[model samples]
Target: MMNDTTFETLPGRRRSDVVYKTLLDRLYSGQYARFSRLPTERELTEEFDVSRPVIRNALAKLRDNGLIRSVQGSGSIVLYEHARGDDASAGQVSIGDFQKCFEFRVLVEQEAAFLAAKHCDRAALDVIRQNIDEVDRYVQRGEYRIGKSFDFHRAIAMASENPFIVQALDRVQDFIGFKIYIARSMSLPNPVERLALINGEHSAILSLIERREGEEARALMRSHIERARDLFLGCLPLEVVSDREGR
Candidate 1:
């Protein structure tokens, strides 16, 4: 809570909404620490000068957003602090660090794909297929789901039967999102085109792995990563990325 923790005089008509934004702002600002319980209904009511119902409704919104969890005995607890554009660290990745990381991943993942092609059992391949189908369904409906695409890659990493590969992907899989940011930057009339291409690339990779074409699978995996890297880099300012890379 701020030293000057302030609230506008919340009127009855929109008190619950005001309370929700107030609490969410606090959560994102770290006024409520992760995993720490929020004030009780009685305390919130007093603090916000709102009814218990207003406070409860406000808490419900946070719960719906997966930001907080409410236990029966305890109160609402903070979970994530989703950084918005204004956050100091938002989208401020070092280009040199990203290039190094991506280069390392290209090697790790190519081997993973090669091994997955050779060793993945039917069940393992099915797990990868399920994630692919999830993306296909979303893309058919014209949604570019970055998380779904990430899940498909994670499944392939798991199918490699290499715990290190799995662990590595878990750590760095979120980097794929820069590709999403780049695709969105283009502002194409058909946003689904980028997603469709991504899904198609995944389908081709999966097919090669399923057929146990280890050599071909490795090649496809490297090409796929390179293509996505190009797409992501294409939209960025070259001078900025080059300057940072030199650093």
Candidate 2:
């Protein structure tokens, strides 16, 4: 581990941005262990002398950057780990981490979608449908439920009837939760627009799966995930997803 590091207070930065950046630097320095829950919202609110919403927004930024994850009643867990100079104690989710996760998703999930086309029954598709509708409800209220989207994807993974694929996705799901939100947030800034686009994609995938069109389902799933990467991480060229779709 590297030596203990302290975050300096910067002048002229938004209070929430200050809190977010401070926490992030601490993360990059390995002050927080991966998978460990952070302080409660109340505690952070007091520590930062900010309102709950400020603390929430700050944490939201961390989540958007894929440096932390939210857990029910447990607060956010730190996921980012990085090295500076000779300090190589690794754990944080950098752009490199995001890209690696995206690559894995493209690899594992595309096949999962393909297999799901062959094996998915009405029950499995119903789970996805329910979750997608729930997501739309959240978006309608101008909120984004990252967990809901994760559930939708996991439903597809389960429909594949492949334990190994399901296991692999579960391993990285906590982190995947953040990226799902971030990509959706950036690619579709308007809640209504995002709701329509996300549900549309899910519907298309499910339709192809129901028809047992494995190859088409596979390609569309790959493209869908790649579209997210392009939106959130700029992994592919700009033209890979035109502004119309990303918007």
Candidate 3:
């Protein structure tokens, strides 16, 4: 049986909790069958009269809880039954798998950052600078702003002048954002130090790009991503480390 108390705190829930209860009832009643596709984002937005971001947040929560999976280029599919036996539910990432993910990121983002330096327009540079400033503000205020940080990276990726790189970044945005958020939330001591390091790296990359130093930009990006991989590994629990290695 689902934990009623904990369920009330889910993303779609409110003080009144109508949406939470409705969804939970439907889920338990099997209205969304195993392996069935959920309503599209547009459909859900229309049905609920909520903004797309709110709907996306709700779906993200569902996905994290193993109730659903969003297949890229397709749509969200119900995975409740499958999750009963799925390793994903345990939130494990193997070391090798984690390294592979970082490797892939380095390969793509270094080129993307270099191209962004080579081809980015003044307007795009302004956006990137603004994002960096936003991160600075959040850090100075001791505010946790993982979303803003992710947006900064996304802005850089979009400015890369490569459509494929933009698409790839978009696909992993949620995963990357959530992992950072989780790491920050779980930190025992001075999370600000780590966040500051990240901010400094962002500034370095942006500065290189603004100077039209493509090779320097690529080098900085590679270092920045490798650092992120290390931080993520440090933040993961022992059990999750095993899972990450397996992946």
Candidate 4:
């Protein structure tokens, strides 16, 4: 139950962007279950009080992002479902793919964190902080919102003042998102505990960035990613774990 005014008043953001972000947040928070139909375009138009074109554009963006699929008569179906115990279905990513994605993040995001520590302005810091707050709120409600975690990392990349870094991250976002889903689902016993661990690492990184400690931020970022990689890899289903070892 989000207040309409929340997206309505985001300064300097387009209407479509607002709609996309809001819907993305909802999808990641499990508000829209997998295979569940979303509100119709007309319904969304009425709810947001925007033009039909605007709603269509937002829906199109969601489809492009792999978060939803459009059925001819059924409207949009949310695709971000909870990961079951099946490795093949848990994001369709292999252990090697997970390792590669994490390795890429370590290479790019560590430098991004270091640069963000040196270059992050107040506004950028606020955006990252807001993302963390959103994650905390969702965790409190027993929901795992992967979008907030992605947003937090992207904001830090933007704060680094490197468009290429942002682009690099964005290009891999879908795969990274799937990886995150698997990790959150399999890494720990309690969802709250796993999310708290992630949120704590994010907060620590943010603190280091704010304190302008570039080296410390970089080191911590590496450790944070590595820890998550190891945890998820260890907790993967036994068959997949065996595959990785056999390779």
In candidate 2, the residue pairs with backbone N, CA or C atoms under 3 Å apart (3 or more residues apart, or in different chains) clash, namely 80-92, 80-93, 81-91, 81-92
Candidate 4, poorest ten consecutive residues by summed lDDT: 238-247
When 2 and 3 are scored with lDDT, the better candidate is: 2
**Residue 216 C-alpha lDDT in model 4:** 99
Query: Candidate 1, TM-score vs. the true structure?
Result: 0.60
Tens digit of per-residue lDDT, candidate 2, span 63-151? 75566889887889887544344332122234555667889989999999999999989998888788888878866766544545667
Query: After superposing candidate 1, which stretches have Cα over 4 Å from the reference?
Result: 1-91, 174-190, 237-247
For candidate 1, write residues 69-175 as lDDT tens digits. Answer: 88888878776543446544343455555566667778888999999998899999999888888878877765444545767777888889999999987667345
TM-score of each: 0.60, 0.63, 0.61, 0.62
Alpha carbon lDDT of residue 149, candidate 3? 67
* Candidate 3 Cα outliers beyond 4 Å, as residue runs: 1-82, 87-91, 174-189, 244-247
Q: Ranking under TM-score, best-scoring first?
A: 2, 4, 3, 1
Model 4, 29-67: lDDT tens digits are: 568888999999888888777777778877775775467
Q: Lowest lDDT 10-mer window, candidate 1? A: 179-188
